[model samples]
Target: MRAVRFHEHGGPDVLRVDEIDKPEISAHEILVEVAGAGVNPVDTYIREGATQPFTLPMIPGIDVGGTVAAVGDGVSGFDIGDPVYGTGIGKNHYGGYAEYVTVPDDRLVQLPEGVDPMVAGAAGVVSGTAWRALIDHGNLQAADTCLIHGGSGGVGHAAVQIAAASGANVITTAAPTYHDALTDLGADVVLDYGRSDLADAVRDAAGGGVDVILDHRLHEYLQFDADVANVGCRVLGIGENETGVGFERSSATRRKDLQLTMMTMFNTPDLRVPLRKLAYLMSEGDLEISIAETYGLEDAAKAQQHVIEESFLGKVVIVP
Candidate 1:
């Protein structure tokens, strides 16, 4: 089996494709013949030594979609040849940047009928994160006006659709080029963050301020988010700045009595439920996963570099 391994943290240069032994599954785990692996910013951070507590020769990826190749003892409700998709490895074991991956039975969901494996892999982490942030934590409702920062990116895009499907008014920030596409994805309004004051734009779009905010660029947009949130609004911060930057004190949030929360997708103990919900949405055509690009398994280095270079819509997948 071939896998991407980083013996030392640095840049994309640290990733190398090497032939490694296939992962052996424990009694509670299952072996998957990986079809696709999703790449994310955290993978790059781990590669660059930005995220810590990882050992050398680590395999870097969490989301994977594949077919069950073998099942370990005590694994029930799933069998060989079942199509499954969800977060894999990465947390405490080797991850999905490989030909085969060992995954705990609890973390995966059976792919819904007619769902593509690539799309499932792409939806794995981002969709689950969006589900938790907007529905579980933010408590978004039908009457709420929601502003999603970086709406064209992976999690943001998913948030837009999820919010819209729940009957909330969805506002999002993106480049002008993606505005129309995002609108089609359920964003009621799209603000060009590069050209306009996001706070003002959001306020104008929502007729004063929004009821909820899904913030992906925390440090870059936190104050602006606070400025444009309605009184007692909820703001969910999804991404963290790498530099540990601080925000200036402001009376906007204080005066409004806003509720702000920061969330890491991994903080959610289990992804099985969220992934199943997202899978149902995908299967029903109520939601769609955007895959920006796909690369060969051996091109993990290039894929990670692509994620670091610029903001792209949706996810980048590595097909094994």
Candidate 2:
């Protein structure tokens, strides 16, 4: 099998496609013939040795969509020809950047009818993360006003649709170029993050304050989030600056008794549940996964670079 592996962590240049042996499955693992693998910002970080330690010569994809090529003896409810997609493929194991990857049976979900493998692969991480952040951790409700930062990225775009489908008044921040697209995705209000009065704009959009905030760049937006958060609001922190930046808790955050929770999709004990729900949403056309670009498996380096250095409104996928 051909796989993209980085022997050492540094930059996208470190990723190289090489012919490798196929991974064997454990009793509870299933072997997937990779059709599409989603490239995330975290993949870049992992390649740069920024995240937790990993085995050298690592495959860096976290999300995968493909068919079951082989199943372990203990694996059930999946067959050799079933289409599947899910996350956790790259974090704890070699990942999905190869022609074949061994994934735990529990981590793979049957692709809902009519959902494309590439779409499923691209949505695995972002959709699951958005669902967990807004629905599970944030407890966003239909009556709530939700504010999502970086609403043009992979997770941001998914969050916009998820929040909107949940009936929340979705207020998102993105560049002017993405405003109309975000609104089409169910964002009730889309503001330019570059606006000097972003906080005020958010407050006005949400009618004084927002009930929930999904923030990825907390170091840059923590104070701003506090400024526009409603009393007893929930702030779900999905990411932060990698530079060891510090942020002060604003007086409004304390005064409003807001709840601040930092989360990573990897922490979810059961991904299949949310993924199943997202799958239903996708099948029903309530959720849409946009593919910003697709690259061949050999161009994994370019895919990783585009994920970090480029500004795109969806996921970058690798077709193996």
List runs of model 1 lying over 4 Å from the truth.
Answer: 245-247
lDDT of 2 by residue, 154-179 (tens): 99999999999999999999999989
Which candidate number has the best lDDT? Answer: 2
Score candidate 1 by lDDT.
0.84
- Which residue runs does candidate 2 get wrong by more than 4 Å? 242-249
Clashes in predicted model 1? 0
Cα lDDT of model 1 by residue, 1-320, tens digit? 99888898897888889898888889989898988889987788777887762577898888888999999998998889999898835757777888899889878889978998777877877888898999999999997999988888888888899999999988888888889989989888888978656667778889988898888778787777778878988989887666563456676458878888888878777778888888889898878888888988779999988887866888899897
List the candidates' TM-scores in order: 0.96, 0.97
